[model samples]
Target chain A: MGKRSARLENEMIEYLPRMRRFARSLSRDAADADDLVQLTVERALTRLDQWQDGTRLDSWMYRIMKNAWIDETRRRQRQGRHLAPPEAGESVGAEDPDFDKRIRAMSVERAMATLPDDQRIAVGLVLVEGLSYKEASNVLDVPMGTLTSRLARGRKALEAQLNPDSVEAGHDD
Target chain B: MMIDDETLIAFLDGELDEAEMERIAVAIDADPALTDRLERLQLSDQAVRETYQPIAEEAVPDHLIAAVRQADRDTAPDSETVLPFQRPTGDRPSRPAWQAYGAIAASLVIGVLIGSRFGLTEPAPLHFEGDRLLAGGVLATALDRQAAGAVGEGDTHVQLSFATDAGGYCRAFQQGGTAGLACREDGRWVVELTAPVPAGSNGPIRTASTALPTILLEAVDARIAGETLDAEAEAAAIENGWSGDPD
Candidate 1:
């Protein structure tokens, strides 16, 4: 580890909670989620010179987590580590009913797994995390329209998972 | 009243300005379908956020806190910009940037240094055995007996002999109106390159015989570890079988 300012380091620590939340929202596995966080922190620390002091640290952190997740996902795909697919998320919860937190985490992971990487991240950043569309798009490095479209698609997918009946009822509007 | 989903989303997320929000609000008020669509998007988001609440509220796993606090083990900040291609100073002996291209043909006869001083005459057909030049024929005879300053048979002259930074010996010479650089490898001379010999060439890289082509001069500059072998050193190299002894 090279020497970074204590201020930057402390600020990064302050933001770890939401960073982990965003990481979990992107990655399906807890271990992988934490791994993404670890990778992002390491990257951000190593590249602290790139960060401006007054800018939103959360925004910068989110972008790093996003890029790190993409790299991690590609590596995992290359390594054939695609973790038994989304179907496993549903069944694993049923089999391990005693762990409530595990069940809740798995259920969220299950809902998240319904969307592709792009849409899921859009939803995670905008709808769930309450980033303004502009900020979310900035984090995503996408235009506002692209971010909204992905978020809409991601919401529709999660809506289906949440209220299967509403989707079946054909909320055509 | 038929707003696209992205526009509707921007409206629902309050990303629109007051005017656009007002317009969408009026449109939604008049259209139950729009209202329902907005409701669904909002409800889905609410439900997802609720599901995620526990994760955010859950105690940051001790492991994660430890990871965040473990700054000493984390990157210091410049490592991320370190170029991916500039690998650490490593043993990069992988067929280097030093590309020497030429061929030793079995029958493509070379206009050898017809050296009378070395008792050599006429051209020789030098061939490659496994890409290593077999110092055969008149050229080999000139090189083996008197590789130093042996301008024996014609205007051809062995201008200089020097050991390379790569621990190999190279000889620069002009023959048959062509200049060439040959470096010793595996006990045999490999004609690294040969170009049409230039006349009166004084390149910035060196001030040797102007007749020495710039290619040969540059080749010597690129390879010579220290200095070209003096006459005594060249004689000693001949005595040592030119065994890459770095004389």
Candidate 2:
């Protein structure tokens, strides 16, 4: 946390909530999401020097979160902790657990979990997190074109999982 | 233009230009089924966002922040020169990045494994250009030109260099201040590996002043094609006409 990346630091702090949301969506568990967020922050802080001034802060943060999520998942799998849900609650509104919110959130997490790591991350960044194509691209350190393609495919795949009927409907249209 | 998912998504995110968004909006209006499908996409996005929104808003716990800050403090010492391949010693478990790579390899031929990670591969070995060249310049030159015997008790030293069978090269050299290595092929010398060779063992990492480390040497070996060079061989090879690819 050098004082030099002051703007970046401020941006990072401001965006922590969004980053946490993105991480939570990926990890699905409070503890794991927290760990992922911490790792992302640590990495961002350490490598603050690598970030260019012109780039969007959210994209860079997303990339860090995505990488951290991948690493954490790999570590968990290596430790044979795959089956246990990473998060304690099933839904985002787990604290509430009322019917509509609970049902939607649980289904979303379940569908999200079924996705391959890359696809899930792309969807999480672009759709769930509402990152701009350019912003998500910078975070992934992928070319903008690559990010767009990934987002397109990821969303399509997610739709197939969450609402297979929609795919058929999509084809019919 | 035909509607693509990227275009649709850009529309969904409110990122499309007015024309693109308007075009999609017209299409959605024209087809009831398309409107339904787009609505589902939007709802799903809302659902996911709603689910994770709490986590986002919740304050970052002090413990997590504290742990990260501690890791920063712990690693700050070696942040600048932490090589990618050096292993951790018993004394320092929280090794820097390079030492962590080396520590991971300590179980086996850490050196060779470390070499390949930095792209000093067997067939298509990595060559140093701008930053890499500056990063490992003198040490690479010393490794190519000097022999162990010629290494002085002074601040710089040449430890090793060899041309592998595959036509790539690897070297381990040291600034008397820092023990490290440099390897060359096709006129480009990439510092693939480095470590503090003890002055006794060459005064190990603490004594080595140069930035290149032994972990990078492992990277070099992982990619080299044939055996490395001894002093005499390097001299002879340099004297003969040289080209980027080994003949």
lDDT on C-alpha atoms for all candidate structures? 0.62, 0.57
lDDT of 2 by residue, B1-247 (tens): 3576677777887878888788899998998777776776776677767777667667777545443433333344434442322223555432233343233223222232433334333222223355563223233334444454243322234444556666655555543223444445556565544454322221244432222332444454455554445447766655542233342
DockQ values, each candidate: 0.16, 0.22
Q: Using lDDT as the measure, which candidate wins?
A: 1
| iRMSD of prediction 2 | 11.3
lDDT of 1 by residue, B30-82 (tens): 99888887887777677667656555665666545444434422342332332
| Highest-scoring model, DockQ | 2
The list of candidate 2 runs beyond 4 A from truth reads A1-11, A53-58, A76-90, A161-173, B67-247
